[model samples]
Target: MDESSRRRFLALAGGGGLVAALGCRASGARSELVKPLPDALFIRHGAHNAETRLESLSPGQLVTPNDRFYVRNHGPTPRLSAAGWRLEIHGDAVARPVSLTYDELVTLPSRTITRYLECAGNGRAFFAELLGFAADGDPWRDGAYGVATWTGVPLARLLGLAGLRDGAAWVMPVGLDGDGYARPLPLAKAMMEDTILAYRMNGGPLPMDHGFPARVVVPGWIGAASVKWVGALEVSTREPMVPANTEDYVLLGADYPRPPPVLTTQVIRSAVCMPWPGLLPAGRRTIYGLAWSPFGAIARVEVSLDGGHNFTRVARLIGDDLPVAGTWWQLELEAPPGELSITPRAVDEHGHTQPPLSQQRLNDKGYLFAAPVPHPIRFV
Candidate 1:
């Protein structure tokens, strides 16, 4: 990395720790200290918060560097020692409940996979900006997503050791943070080959903020499903309904009379990584960004300089085209010196296309805003 990049990386990693320390001092003996904002790598949403700036993600970058990876914590980041951590597997449907210490879990067969974890509320700001329909929750742009290589044991392997009794259905993973946050996964998803109990991230021990001892990794699903600081797994015969599932993560709108459907696999979406209100030199330039689909890989991406009125197919794709997750795409184009509106639309292998903001469904919680993102630029 160059000087500028290295500086940004350090600011993101080290600055956060400094802010955290200060926040703890200010709170003074409180169990939960607010997260401090970092000067680089992200924009602050709260005291214990940072979201990646879309422009920081360059074209063709595969694994999101751990320092630059975004942080999404529901509560304060817990300070837990790995040596004393244990993951308990129990509940109504397991024949033999088991508690595996951190060391014991790491000794099991391990597998690694590259997957992207996106907050379901990604692109929320677009609802108010583009469609004039504001909703509640974090007004995230497109930076609340990142792809990483996670190494750990398949969740199913651990479930097998616990021995699921007949009629076992849902798998609830609970975190170790404040008051404990938990989410449930269907038995099928929990047993999928890709789902894992990740202990290492990017070939290193998982970062404390990201889940130190262990966490569940449900590839291609909303980040909430892969609970961080996971300490227990409750294998149950009935669907698990916790606050994370019933009160949040489910869609609610005028169109639905009853409780809306829960958000599972993320919708197809794309974003341009250029600076907001960017100034670009006239003539030829290449535009770059990422496109992802929880159902499958992005099959095609189209770019439009004049908003969404007309689109030209992307000239090339720059990263691994993993059929089950996210990929980066780039386009080369010529522009005259003037104001320009750039938009990119993506279609996944599953035939899901990025919808226009006007046609998007409004949810009470402002989740899954997957429209073709509009980025403004000035050609100097």
Candidate 2:
């Protein structure tokens, strides 16, 4: 970040600027939003955030359409032309600092990845609503995540071009959004071939709301790790201490360490594809949902139509079963109809399954709530 960027960031940091810059819980969110968030597909959180409506999910839909993808913006979406965009590589750890134009980046080498990007606070609201734990941040239901195919140049290739120094440990990709939004990534993770500076999404030029010219897509990690509208990759020997890692995304709770652990890979989470507090006719019906884990592929999905009393395994896993890519599962049940509670639990290949409500603990920000939440529906 340059002096002008530093000054702008400082200004945003002072006087309750953190909430605004981060798009945390706030009023008048629509006033600050820049994208056309249609009500049919999304539930707007604030100016810089819009979650996909899980009810809109259809059977066999493997990829989240570009327009329907959830948005998690640190600041308003930036409108940068590919012709004018340049990705700068610099810092003490970089031996040969260089700036590459949009055209130059795409021409090198490229690969496409089908991965799921989820916010650290994707199910934040569940803590209070389901677990009775008070927490802060957006009240994201289970819809703050989506899977998409991202096409881009590998970060490692770019780092190789820049020539890294011996002690290079952290790679912080800075965004072009206000105050240069960014987060520090470990050198090891940055070197992974899956980590890419994506320029295209779902087979089309990245939308302006989604970082237009380019963005970093860090699969399996918290969405914050994948900064959008990326403008610079600042390499460093020491860990970079920005608001994102230090204060915002860090886990805060009495159960956690004094400093709070910096959130990383997403947890095993599952969600039903029906409306929250939905309705269904009294008869035989099939229940459908999606489940995923950063740890490994989902091994099994169990559904409890009668709440937590008993769980029945889904008929089969559907679509792609890629670990970080997520998979869909469905089951049939005879409905006697009245008021019904449907709970879904997923077990990953590592044997990690969603915890029951009895085992859930409170976290300050309501992050990573992976307990089995019962979806309520009325049969008419």
Candidate 3:
């Protein structure tokens, strides 16, 4: 990264920690994770979830530090060593069932790609806090996502090795944590070259807070589809309506389409690096933030000083703008004293931009809230 780029990205790293968990508070299921939760880097949501503090993103640091990445667990993080790890591939859709030990799995051809992993409910808090649309689950405010370089065997290679038979419609990766937590992926997505069973994160062996031993890393899809501590891949001829899919990630709300659309690829989203509710002294400064999409690279970013009524394109973009990955940007502006709200909206390569606040609606689970909402600030 260049000097100018590094400084732009570092501006977001200056804020203090979030004072509270945005909206509703819940003591969800207990997590068995043994990793330490340092207050400076994370905002805790009960015992199971630890949200990454966006302000911790340092200058020129594109790959999220494994230790600072967010943790969303349904159960406890299991203790598994590579020597004892085994991956079972089976189901009616596989012509031949196969079980590969960790050693055997790593011997296969592997690929590395940098992409962002984000929860389907990453911005759930906006629903209730901004739009008055009540949502369930932990109230996350854009911290449930991060970018990482993942190295692993392409999932297609594994399926091929197991003789993936014709007529397979879904691939469900089951985890070793809590009742084998699993979510189904369409066979087509599972066969995509970018989909992999990753064993390394940011060039290091996976951390326990992440998936130790191995985990699924499905690019361009919701994070839940990338099951951690994976133990088995269950190929099926039909959709596997597990709670992760049908009950949880599925869109729920009176305004949504009937049958509730099951979330697949994530949409365009962006967030400023400063504090959620920031206070600043009157002056001129450069604003920094990151924007991305599952469909493509960000085409442009516009910031609005007066809520969502008006917007101006960011002064410059920093770093490589890879598809399905995020890029940092900076905008120079003059500030006046008193109350202010800065809202950043991103446009993707597909011509998709954030919905206006007028069009925002609540999903039953608060799965996707991509509309632009103001980031309140006080300029003293």
Alpha carbon lDDT at 58, candidate 3: 74
Model 3 error, position 6 (Å): 48
The TM-scores, one per candidate, come to 0.90, 0.91, 0.89
Candidate 2 matches the true fold with a TM-score of 0.91
Ranking by TM-score: 2, 1, 3
Tens-place lDDT digits, model 3, residues 216-307: 99988898889997877888898877787767788877877767788888878988777778888889967777888898888888989888
Task: Give the lowest summed-lDDT range of ten residues in model 2.
Answer: 12-21
- Displacement of residue 111 (Cα, Å) in model 1 is 1.2
In the predicted model 2, the residue pairs found to clash are: none
Best model per TM-score: 2
- Number of backbone collisions per candidate: 3, 0, 2
- Alpha-carbon runs more than 4 Å astray in model 3: 1-31
For residues 92-193, write the lDDT of model 2, one tens digit per residue.
999998888888998988989999999989888888887677799899998889999999999999999999999999999987766677899999999999
Q: Any idea what lDDT model 1 has?
A: 0.80
lDDT score of model 2?
0.82
Error of 3 at 140 (Å): 0.7
For candidate 3, the per-residue lDDT at 289 reads 78
